[model samples]
Target: MQQLLDHVAALKGEFDREVFTDSYWAIRDEYDLGAADEQFWPPVFQRAGIESDPTLVASAAAKDAELASTIAREPHQLLLEIADAGVPLGILSNAPHRMAQSVRESDWASVFAHLVFSSEHGLMKPDRAIYDLAASHFSDVEPSTIHFFDDRERNIVGAHAAGWHGHLWRSVDQARFELRSLGILTKR
Candidate 1:
């Protein structure tokens, strides 16, 4: 990632990380709400004084997309176990289109009955609508019986507001313990 950034900096004469960060945050919600990677990267590059060359932007976007594939590995086995236990599983995430696509193509994708990406839904975490949207997929289950785990407190609060059981995710073990306590997972 740094290599890509460095290459952009070389081409543009100057690149400021803070500028890039600010630019990204400014449009992150829009990006997560289905904006194309092609749209997301140019502003970020321009803000950082990096040349917004299409190929460079694509390279950066591809690198960013790879993050979803790498980060979700820890929960793969646990998700598979839950699926094997006959529990319906879903993923609700605030992500750009590329990252969402990457996750859908991942090996663990099969374990989930639904993949709810804000990029496709136009609603991101902490939004009541997004929570409701996720819950809608589990129509047969009561809202309280739906368990949601998120690393962000605001998102957890939103889940709770939606009448679903929400757990703050600290680690895979913590999630397992919480799910077991909620009767969503049996002791193994």
Candidate 2:
């Protein structure tokens, strides 16, 4: 998944002001502002003009959909293929809830068994709580049996720490090969 991670990292640098603004607000709410240091909010919130209620902060995310759709890559097809093989799929992302909605609307939601959005969970990845939440869903399966694919190194590292095998997503080809090597897919 190096390719995916690289691509996302590149996109982070290219993120427009609107996208960053929306992401900042979304993240602020996901972590629960009350527990966060006061220093974290003002600069970001001042730039975005975020208010006390998170819903308004969340609404700032509407600007992201346009930019995100433009960056669509090939890995989602691999995700769908893996899901079609009857391996349960779950999405654990730090994106706002609307981001998941956009993915669902993009004809990909059917592939996912569960979507653990940070906004919905009030916890972001790199945090053990969110990773545990995803793990909890597969109580019948050993943590090692559930493979997680994420485009961020931090998230992948966190998943590993939580006892779930993770694929640090880069490219579709690399991810497919990893799954095959893991015996999740058979060679034709």
Candidate 3:
């Protein structure tokens, strides 16, 4: 999230620092999770009463580049364990498009039956619409059978309220333990 803010600041482009900060945050304060960054940046500049640089529009590549470079992605062993146990997996995330595209291109893409990103659907997590949208992807399965794991408590709150089996993610071991309790993990 800091990376996203930094990108916006950089694109503010020679404007007054205070004004840029105010403008950036003003839009963020009322940010519509249903809109993509590509759609969000322009309005921020417009509201600040400045013209956006023609070359400074946000894009999927820009959103992804910093995260891909700085974050170390460890092995998703729990997902692998679940896959080995023949559980149908799905991923639901509130992020930009490139992140989702990267996951789809990953070697383990086959482990998940579906991957839903807010950037593609235009609705983010904690919003009933996105959760319902994800649920629709597994219409054949009962809600009682689905499990969702995320690090954020707020998102888990939303998931729980929506009738998803939500787990606050910590480590793979803890997640496996929880899944074991629910009979979703056996061998691992």
Candidate 4:
């Protein structure tokens, strides 16, 4: 788990260091910058390679749109299994409200008892306020009884600080094992 966390941390560092260079800003300017919204920036920055040109940004946006559509939905077997055991399930995600609503529109939302999105609360993960909000949902359950699963290490750390058991999510199998170890999920 420590090694997995280290790898994720390293990837985050690399992305932060390389993805938002001066060339990205230049490309943003070429796109008539302010005209394009925040949603366009990530793919533009990733694809443009810092040259800051309209063609690159356009190309990047097209590629990103294709990639987004191509994303395969993973089976929520573990989530369903956990929920079937009658354990209360909650989601605390940093995703935008639209994304959260989309998740609910999909089959995944049925698996959770509560879904807390950062954008709706004006707070994001790793911020104690968001965790506190999530914690509030499980009022009947002790803080230690509430287990949190997130892909981000910082969020997991925050969960721990907020007195909840935290699992650094990687695969569903790993997550299941962690939940079982914490006595939150029963073995089939």
Residue 70 error, candidate 1, Å:
2.6
Please report the TM-score between candidate 4 and the true structure.
0.64
Report the lDDT tens digits of candidate 2 across residue range 34-111: 223233333454553433345433333434443443334576667667877888887777755556557656666667
lDDT of each: 0.83, 0.63, 0.69, 0.62
List residue ranges in candidate 4 displaced over 4 A. Answer: 1-75
For all the candidates, what are their Cα RMSDs to the real structure? 2.6, 7.4, 4.5, 8.7
Clash count list over all predictions = 0, 6, 0, 2
Q: For this target, which candidate reaches the highest TM-score against the unseen true structure?
A: 1
Show the lowest summed lDDT stretch of 10 residues, model 4. Answer: 28-37
Model 2, runs deviating above 4 Å: 1-60, 69-73
Which scores greater on lDDT, model 2 or model 3?
3
What's the distance in Å from true for residue 4, model 1?
7.6
lDDT minimum window of 10 residues, candidate 2: 32-41
Listed in order, each prediction's TM-score against the native is: 0.87, 0.67, 0.68, 0.64
**Residue 145 error, candidate 1, Å:** 0.7
Q: Who wins the lDDT comparison?
A: 1
lDDT (0-100) at residue 74 of candidate 1? Answer: 61
